[model samples]
Target chain A: MSNRDRIEVLFWGIGGQGLVLASIILAEAVGVYEGKNVVQSQAYTAIVRGGTSKANVIVSEEKEILFPQVLSPDILVAFSQEAYNANKGKLKPDTKIIYDSDMVKIEDNVPFKLYGIPFFKIAREELGIPFAGNVVALGAFSAVTGIVKLSSLERALLSKVREEYHEINRKALERGFELAEKLN
Target chain B: MSKNVRLMQGNEALVEAAIMAGVRFFAGYPITPSSEIAEGFSKKLPRVGGKFIQMEDEIASMAATIGASIAGVKSVTATSGPGFSLKQENLGFGIMAEVPCLVVNVQRMGPSTGRPTKPSQGDIMQTRWGTHGDHPIVVLYPTTVPEVFKYTIEAINISERLRTPVIFLMDETLGHMREKVLLPEPDEIKVVNRKFPKVGKEDYLPYKPADDDVPVIAPFGKGYRYHITGLHHNYKGYPTTQPEEVEELTKRLLRKVERVLDDIFILNTYMYDDAEYVLYAYGITARIAKEAVNILREEGLKIGLLNPITIWPFHEDKIEGLLGGKKKVFVVELNSGQMKGEIERIYPRKDVIGINKLNAELINPYEIADHVREGLR
Candidate 1:
């Protein structure tokens, strides 16, 4: 991508599903680790969990990230059917939609490029850590979009989480990368 | 460039800067968008040998901050719109008493609890005229996360140097947005501490003006004991109803800031040398304006930006010089034409256009670029 180009990503899901954490990891990877300018913002309900939560992460190679909110995101990662439904109107013809195959269902006639991954199923059944689904999604996003390196994401994740949880999260991320590779 | 770059939110930057500036006391009540400052200080202050108190309410928080400042500690209090209103009386007291302290208002939508989480520049005018008296105040608004960190230190320095209350105004957008900031090393940052009375205790006058029109304040518990009250006071700090004493005190308070306006006034200009259309903004709105200016510049339009880093004690001279030959000026804000009035007053000949957004939403870059396109056509 050109230095002037910016990639905008949106993570939408229930408040308990770790969408905010996913956005933070992505932003830190690109901004802190990769030395690119990034702006991350979120909108969530007042309640702690179960309400709609949305996080916007904009990564730009420019000297500044001028606008904090993403009006027309280039990539959308929806972890639930409610999130996908709520954000359908924001999609353009060239927008890329990444959804949880186990939770979100898209109509067949949609024009956007869609990638569905069973992040929840892999985290719970294979990894035995349901909370690791967000990391899995992050890995898939990095692999599919090439917006950030999977290695950088893992490093950012390890820096943010506790030492004891690092091994499981690393496995979850690798599982996601493998799943994305299979899809391609 | 200190390679210690970290992703920090605006609120977190404020706390970190305040602590670095020797802010040893923080008294605040939790309020949305501004609560992070309190929370961060709660965890970090004790480790740094500072104190953080969750006051019963905004009023108490303001009072406690002033009390701490009087005791010679660098103090701060953070709140949003409703809490800001509650702190106004004490804020005015701090002004009258010449207590050096920082008051951060992370502004959200409001008349009365309008939208706790949404961004707004509604407090732009309120921070200036909120208190019910004719007193001088310093208000600084930062447009970016790094600016937030830098300006917080500037706010504390100005408050200490001028012996007055400083308002660090931020909006919900900047308060919540996270960005990469190069954290400055301790020796790399310049810190200013309030000057203590140099004279013998027997000859010290608490309100006596020095060469800079600011009195050297002695901490309350110090040996140079003096009285302080919200009432107009004489040079010795005794309450006085005499017209001459009150007028002299008020004029000195105003003159201290006014005379040094050139030093305190801060603003940034972009592509303004040959521009015909100048956009004036601050806080998050200015960030969008910067992007809009870049887009318009690419499209071969002579558009530029003038963002006020210091919102109060208006940068009249700099703005007048910057808009010398500009034909039209656009004032973009998240309020209903608040700062636009100031622009109109300063540049009456120019057609000052106001692009206002008050719907609890941010004014996007596209909206501004489109507005400029339509206006040009």
Candidate 2:
């Protein structure tokens, strides 16, 4: 019901930034709406608000997911300096790394492709919804990687979030797509 | 129709299935990973006119679940490793009293509170013999969300039919991981209610075994009055000191599950027809081993997976049939070869190799594949 090759993605940021939700949104789009078998998990702990958190999503069109966790990620989205530092040295040469431009600053000596999108800035200043940055990042992820369609991501987000926050989240997602397209 | 196909966690799926299987009482002390089961029960049980209680401790949770089950409702409780340790004593009480309840242990790394957020199969030995007795227990180790859903119903049915506590095992990884599951419609499910006493109050013998070796005990607060104690009991349900009665009662407890292993066993296999080697695994390790089998098969190697969905009351007869002519069996687990020992007890240790991993991280498919390759070379 889906492609044969597996596509692995990782979302990393501080807790409460909604990276876990973003990963789930991407998983829902790929697995539920798009008909692939996917397994998504997050690093959980006693604290839910402040540590370096990670969400790993593996999309496989295989009959069953043999290895549930992402062994190597095709794309890595970082929202904090800690996220970048902890995971930057462990990427394959062709891995796509996207970091929040306003949140993390990196010198360009890495082997993989790096795209810095101002996810938090767009969510805070342009969209007036600070907490919608994860959706913004999801939009950027769709535009940059072309793994999930923008429509799929938007539908997933709309289906997951409440009605009051849908407008700003959609705007945030669109702005993410626009910025990512401009970067390419 | 509302969307049955949605993303959910393993714990959430189990609770949903339990409700469908007629589980109406949940008494649990929330712990990480397994806490979602309690949380789901808390939210959904009340909506269905059931009861959900956050007990003071895991022991109380087990006691309360047993109490509720004996009070004429299907009951369940969930806990993690440390809490599982705490519930062991009362769990034995449920076994001796022949109460039907479900105890879900979502394991984390631990002898104590080792790692709350990490995964472990450390409870493999504990789940079998944790309580201090020779009594039989039915323990199911499900690897995925869908299995959790299906086997939750199966577990409730088994416990109801057998009149014993069923341990439903999950780990931190499966409990927390999200997967897209198509929830089964209610009509597709067959709920098993426990056998209640048919005789009037005068002739009811609470501990008298029927043809199936299961006692149709009367529920508490009913018109029937009888003794229910942890001590060795007679057919009259009172504590007994007679050695023959204790032997008969004890033997009957085990015969309940042993006689029907065919009905309770669920062993999942992949590509077993022509495989030369076996990857023996359970829980999340089985999921990884299944992947390792696929990866090795792509390399033109004949490898297969023998996954035990039911971990305890080891289905030796079925497993023996599956592993008869295999070249080598690799018992892969998240702990230090707990089930490897069990497998070795059947097959010689020389024929069974152990692949062990116990840190917070999961052992990937490559690690398993590499083990097989290294062993072959």
Highest-scoring model, DockQ = 1
Error of 1 at B329 (Å): 0.8
User: What is candidate 2's lDDT per residue for A130-178, written digit by digit as tens?
Assistant: 8888888888888898878888888889997889878888888888888
What TM-score goes with each of the models? 0.97, 0.96
lDDT of each: 0.90, 0.89
Candidate 1: Cα lDDT at B52:
94
Error of 1 at B351 (Å): 0.8
The top-ranked prediction according to TM-score is 1
Cα lDDT of model 2 by residue, B1-377, tens digit: 12688889999899989999999999999998799999999999999999999999999999999999989899999999999999999999999999999999999999788988989999999999999989898999998888888899999999999999999999999999999888878999899998878788998899999999999988889889989999999998999999999999999999999999998988888898899999999998898888888889899999999888888889887888889988999989889988888888788689898888878678988889999998888
Chain B vs. true chain B: TM-score per candidate: 0.98, 0.98
Instruction: Write down the TM-score for model 1.
Output: 0.97
TM-score of chain A of each: 0.94, 0.92
